[model samples]
Target: MKYVDEFRDRDKAAILVREIGALAACIGRQIHIMEVCGGHTHSIFRYGVEGMLPSRIELVHGPGCPVCVLPIGRVDACLGIAEQPGVIFTTFGDAMRVPGSRKSLMQAKAEGADIRMVYSPLDALAIARANPEREVVFFGLGFETTMPSTALTILQADREDIANFSVFCNHITIVPTIRAILESPDLELDGFLGPGHVSMVIGTAPYEFIARFHRKPMVIAGFEPLDILQSIWMVLKQIKDGRAEIENQYARVVPEAGNAAALRAVAQVYELREFFEWRGLGSIEHSGVQLRAEYARFDAERKFAIPNISIADPAACQCGEVLKGLIKPWQCRLFGSACTPETPLGALMVSSEGACAAYHQYGGKVQRAETA
Candidate 1:
């Protein structure tokens, strides 16, 4: 609570807000700063950060939710693997609700598939340990923050000679996705609130491209309200000074060089795929990772005969444009009326970290006030 209580201090928040307001006035025009993590998106909405900022400042949501960006094809693939006769499919609880082409994992489980919710890949490994005859496949997903645990789990599986355990790797890299967003012809981003958890593992070095090549200021930000306010102030300062560089506002957790052990584990277990499909963003080169040949024995793709196929997103869902900051979640016609969390029509409404779900759950009143 030492880190958390201090970050949530009201006096510190007020000071940061005042400083941010002054910076906003100095800019004197619209400035869009993206928080490239779904956790940040949820925090922003939950803390009413959108309402706190000046009208000229817009906090655009990025495609940082691993579950939101996971393509329907991949979900279908996961479902395919889950439905196998002898397999026990394990995945994070959030992923159970994500709809594939036809149904969700939860739905599949309700219909008699051997689906399970696991907190970690190690939990899936434990399941494999308990069930020797049943094949246990863990659905892997997320950025660098979660990749180390999966890598270490695979290593553990190998060490114990857990022949029945495997992983369905859907892990993605943040840098390439950010690059894709920056390269978009319609982009109007002035700066970025970098992903803190991912930065903790990969370090600040990978984000240099945003500053050096794309000429955008980036601050690796923590998930606290005051931390967000301070990060926004930092980005504004960079823009005012006409400097573009990567800064770490969450220095307490994220180091400049990152964690060497995590990086080594990731490098040992996984290799970047040439291209991977995102639900909204399409296929971006080198955006996803897969198990290395050395770990092929524990690779779920090799272990299961899944229906490897692509499934297009629902035509009515504007998740792609929403992800690109072209529109807010409410702007989509299907937002609250058709795509409530109870029955998500888009990927964004399904996950707690998702922008649509965040706005729906916490930012609805703020959004209404803005419209009024």
Candidate 2:
């Protein structure tokens, strides 16, 4: 609670909010500040940070949730491997609810597939070790934050000679996806609140393009309310001074160069894909990772012959637009009515890290208070 309580202090938050309001007043016109991480989105809504901001300043949620961005085709491929005889499919719980073209992994589990919800890739390895005969497939999903651990697990599996254990690699890079967002013509974002967790691994250097090329300021931010507040102030301060630059507010965890040993593990086990399909963002070049050639024995794609076909997102679900910050979650017709969390029609509704889900659970209460 030491770090947390200090960040959450109401008195400090009030002072920061007043400073941010003054800064926003100087900007004078409507400014769209995008928080390119789901954790920041969650913090904003949870702590009423959005409500505290000046009316002219808007916080747009970007495509940062890895599970939210995971394409349906990938889910279908996972189902194919999961349904295979004598195969054990293991994945994070959030991924099980993501709807494929036909059915979700949850549906497959109900219909008798050996599907297990695992917290980590190492858990899947343990399952493989316990059952030497059955093939254990770990459905890897996330950004750079989780990649090194999964990569390390694969290395461990290779060293231990766990013949039955393999990973269905779906790990994505944040920078490419951010580049994709910046390239979109419809998006008129002024600044960004960068992801702290991903920066902790990949570091601040990768985000220089946001300021250098795109001419938008970015503050690498932590998940805490005060961290987010200070980050907003930093971005607004950049705008006030007409300076576009990348700054780090969460430097306590994220280094300027990032973790060297973690990078080594990732380099050893994985390589960049030519292009990877995102659920909302479509295919972005070099945005995904796959098992390296040396680790071919632990590659799930090679181990199982999967039907790798693209499945289009639902017509009613405006997840793509929502992800791009074109509209709020409630603006989508299917959001609360057809796409409730209990019966989610889009990937964003299924994942807690998703902007839509965060907005639904946390946004409304604060919004109403502010509006009132």
Candidate 3:
């Protein structure tokens, strides 16, 4: 309660709001600050942070949710792997519900495919150890924060001589994707709310380019309301003082250098792919990780033969524009009405950390006020 209660003081929150309002008025321009973490998006909405801010300050959501950015083709590929003889597919719970071209992994599970929801790659490796005769594939997906854990599991499997264990790597980096968003002609961002968890892996050095080249202020924030508010204040202060730099609001958790051992583990097991497909962002160069040549035997794609197919998203979903900060979640015609989380028309709705789902669950009041 020491750290938690202190950051949530109502009086402190009100004072911060007043200060932010003053700063917003001083800027005199429509300042668009995008929060690149899905957790930050959820926190902002859940705490009504957007409603408390000045109207001039706009918070755009970025492609930070791993489950949301996973391409439909990748889901289909996982299904293909799951259906193979003597194969058991494992992944995080979120991936199970994300729809592929025709069916979700959950649907595949119901149809008798060996699809297990695992919390970590280690759990999948344990399964592989238990069933030595059957092939086990861990469907890995996330940004830098989760990659080290996956990398460690692969190393553990190799060390223990677990021949049946393989990895279907869909791990991506945050920096390259952020560069893509910043360089896009349609987006007009003034600053960035950098991802906290991803920063804990790659450190703050990678994000210096956003400030140095693009002159965009960035504040890496935690998931709490006060942490987000303090980060907003940091961004506003930088803008007010005409300084562009990277500031870490979640200093208690994230350091400037980050965890070196975890980074080394990821470097040991994976190499950057030339191009990787995202659900909405298409193929981003050097944005994803694949098993290195040394680890090819443990690569699921290499171990199995499957047809390559590219499928388009639903015609009505505007998830592409939404992810890129070109439009808001509510701007998508299918949002809430035709595409609720229970029956998502797009990946954005299915992911818990997705901008659309956050808006649907917590920003409905703000949406009504805007319409009124």
lDDT of 1 by residue, 1-372 (tens): 986788788888888888888998998899999999999998898778888788889998898999989988889899888888999999999999998879999999999999999998989999999999999999999999899999999999999999999999999999999999999999988999999999999999998888999999999999999889999999999999999999999999999999999999999999999999988788999999999999999998887866568777778999878888899888888889888899988878889888889989987656856786
Cα displacement (Å) at residue 120, model 2: 1.8
lDDT of each: 0.91, 0.89, 0.88
Candidate 2 residues lying further than 4 Å off, grouped into runs, are: 365-372
- The sequence of per-residue lDDT tens digits that candidate 3 reaches over residues 233-302 is 9999999999999999988889899889999999999999998888878888899999999888899989
> Candidate 2: RMSD over Cα atoms?
1.7
Q: What is the alpha-carbon lDDT of model 3 when measured against the actual structure?
A: 0.88
Question: Each candidate's TM vs. the true structure?
Answer: 0.97, 0.96, 0.96
- Which digits, one per residue and each the tens of the lDDT, describe model 2 over residues 1-372? 877899898999899989988998888999999998888887887888887888888888888888888888998899999999999999989888887878899999999999999998999999999999999999999999899999999999999999999999999999998998999999878999999999999888999999999999999999999999999999999999999998999999999899999999999899999999988778899999999899999999987866568877787788878877788777778877888778778867878778778877877445535545
What's model 2's TM-score?
A: 0.96
- Where does model 3 exceed 4 Å of error? none
